[model samples]
Target: MFCYQCEQTAKGEGCKTMGVCGKKPEVAALQDLLIYALQGLALVAVEGRKAGVTDEEANLFTCEAVFSTLTNVDFDPERFVALIKRTVALRDSLAQKVKAAGGKTDFSEAAFTFQPAADLNGLVKQGEEVDLKNASDDNADIQSLKHILLFGIKGVAAYADHAKILGQEDDQVYAFIQESLVNLLRKDMGLQDWVGLVLKCGETNLRAMELLDAGNTGTYGHPVPTEVPLGAKAGKAILVSGHDLKDLEMLLKQTEGKGINIYTHGEMLPAHGYPELKKYSHFYGHYGTAWQNQQKEFAEFPGAILMTTNCIQKPQQSYQGNIFTTGLVGWPAVAHVDDKGCPSLLDKVKSAVGLGCSSQGKDFSAVIKKAQELPGFAADTDKGKVMVGFARNTVMGVADKVIQAVKDKNIRHFFLVAGCDGAKPGRNYYTEFVEKVPSDCVVLTLACGKFRFFDQNLGDIGGIPRLLDVGQCNDAYSAIQIAVALSQAFECGVNDLPLSMVLSWYEQKAVAILLTLLHLGIKDIRLGPSLPAFVTPNVLNVLVENFDIKPISTPDEDLKTILG
Candidate 1:
């Protein structure tokens, strides 16, 4: 498979045998083919757009296809095979339309004209030919930049898909996805060209995230500072994981008054801040920590589990039958709910919960029965509360207070310790980093990474919580907004403010967010647990020279460096 597109790639390098995320060789091969097909479609779409011909459906498909290839998003080889075939059909149709419009079409381009093998072996062969390592470029540095851009696109596609579901669409972001993919195939492009495109990918991702933020806040109302229950309630329940608010909303609506309580999990933990979702009395507190702990946590939970998007690890046999996947997530033999039919998901959940366990050992009632006996959010209050909902509006609403605190020396610095959480060893750096921060500094966090010390009471400074949960990773846009607002209030640039970003990345979404931070000229950011395997030393040099990017040291050392 030779995939090194995630933080936990095997041995800190490419996964040649299988993905650490439970993706088999066949699945990895198919995902590669799917990406190649999407690139081909992008080539045709980019050309067609030159002639003022475009298809929103094609754009949306490209985004969703890339998103599905992200780590733990889909492990179903059959699903990738189907998507590859559909991509070819779409690409060919677009090519024909371009030609009909009197626009030049590249009939010779491999991405545009290559056909997949009818069998799995053929598909693997096709994938092997298009692997990033085998690209025409012989320079590892250039190839690394290309892969960075490709990974960034995957993140952009994910946020774009989320936005599209809420009826929010941005043509410029879609157009950039097609343009960048076509550019990636250009052998004539130089390092500077690739570097420029990588930054542009970050710029486009910012737009994608902004669009998603709009969609989410527009649909569910802006997140408010509400105290979320960190415990579960006493009743039959279902845990909703992943980052899809729409799916959570639908599930909550369908399960209302049906005796099945809904609890947020993983990135969905932030859903409690949304007034529209919390309005449902049945929508209780969050359960578990992050995506990496699901295997153990899911087994211990006494309710059915529904994963709505990426970050799904392979289901353990213990709760395998009790889990359901919807949206773009997939695992072989796992029941999936198609978004086209909302009722399908509800029906599947109902059926799975009602079936109970028979002699076949498929029963989830025991899990649920045990879950109710466990103390959840009700027991968490003794630890005190951490404040969230400090998104752009929330922060800006208290801009004067923050500014005054800074002037009064009550708040000394701001640290954005955010990004994904993984099961890997060095992740505790985040917990220690947040723990060691001086009380005078405010910690801004987002995504599942916040789970590390979210329950820790960091206390508040002048009425502002020391640790601020800035929504999910998709809400990085909000973090940026808060930064920009603070900069304006201070009458200085973001870098000039007493701010530092110590981020941990595990997947493509982190890559995109990092790129966006770079695109905004934010410098001296610290990234860990380790640098991406795809980032060659030469590329790293470029980042260090231009952006002052640094790999993380110990929390004490890094804190001294940043505080100094």
Candidate 2:
């Protein structure tokens, strides 16, 4: 499919035969089709805006369609085909409505269609399917810019979709997603326009992140520092992966006192920091590292694995029967959780109960008893000397301090190092980058990507640690808020400030954040472990010339480049 949009792309190049994430040819083709369908849907919504469409429906569609295309979000061809059909129907219906009103409508031009790999000659001889390679775009740079916008929109769609699922929805974020996608369909779009829209994607995503932060912090409490145990107690256990707090909360509630111990996996590890979630005695600790390790991690664990979102990998048959997927995450054989987030997991947990060896004998009463003794810390509960509200508000409060820090050289430069994590080896560049940051500099990070360096003991500059993890990747919103606050405090534009963004992208969400940075006129940002394959040379030119977006190199070299 020529998909190199993720860190795990084969050989650091495009995944031609199959996705390194274990996505098959048909699945990848369907995903592309689904994305195209969503683009069409975005076009409809954009036109609907002129016809006075309510922002809610338009936004909802934007979020869902985008969510469907995220890495590992949907692998089930059945589910994907259904979504494509739904999107096509939505576009068609909207077009009809517009037609009746005598309004003109346009859709994104279709790039390519899917066919069996065996139908192709050379690639077929190599056992690979020829997929959509964006061949229709005659201009290399415009293709790259289009890819940046397209990928960014996909990323925003993911975060907004998750927020919507939590019973929290924002109309503005959705509208921006629709508006952003539709704007890219124009053939004559300028580089400046693309760059501006990219930054706006970041800004809107920041708002989406803020909305989710509020939804999460308001629903749960602000995340606090909490130590979670690694292994599970003696009982039936269910490991929940991906990044959906509401799903975790509901699962914790349903499985609570039912003798099912719930463990957090992958990005869900941070959920333990949230107040409302950790209150459940049955909630266990984190399982493994990033989502890439899932196939092996899930093998040894004894319980049901519930995938609530992205970063899904092809599963081994050993645990295949026990895995359950909900929301946008899907796989061929895994049982699908229905709309209510209910899957037949409990029965599987029950059946596997007496089959596997227990962490202890019988019940986990002792572990649960021990957990209650530990106290939790969050925004409302931190009570620590270090300030926690460094989001937009706290940043404003300390605006003078940040400006003063820069003035006094206590903070040499500000670096926004953020994005998702994957199986790529060079991703260690992030660990080294954090380690190599000058003592006078402050490092701001977000997303599961930050886990690479978050645990490091980077001592404080004054009272603030040199490396400050703002929160999850979606909390890049918090990072942006802090940046804007600093810029205002310094009485300069954000791009003019002595701040540099060195981002490590693994998924589409990073795409949106990069776009947002560009939209805000932020420049000289470094992005790596690798540039996206979807980006054409022309697109790269647009980014390089306008935003100064560059690939990462040695931490020493990059540090010198940014500092010197």
Global CA lDDT computed for model 1: 0.83
Span of 10 residues, lowest total lDDT, candidate 1: 353-362
Residue 429 local lDDT, model 1: 95
Specify the highest-lDDT model's number.
1
Q: Can you write out model 2's per-residue Cα lDDT over 10-101, one digit (the tens) per residue? A: 88767878888778777777676666556667776666767765435445755776777777788776665555555555566677776666
* lDDT value, residue 421 of candidate 1: 96
Task: For candidate 1, write residues 1-564 as lDDT tens digits.
Answer: 689999999899889887888989888878888888888899888878889888766887788788889888999877777778778877877788998998878656688777889977889788877776666378788889989998999999899988887878899999988888887877788999899999999999999998999999999999888787666666677898999898788777666666667888889888888889979998877778899999999988777788888989889898887788877889888877554323332253333221111122122333344335443233222323345676778778888999999999899899999999998899999999999999899999999988899989888998888988888999999999989988988889999998999999999999999999999999999999989999999999999999999999999999998888
Cα deviation of 472, candidate 2, in Å: 1.0
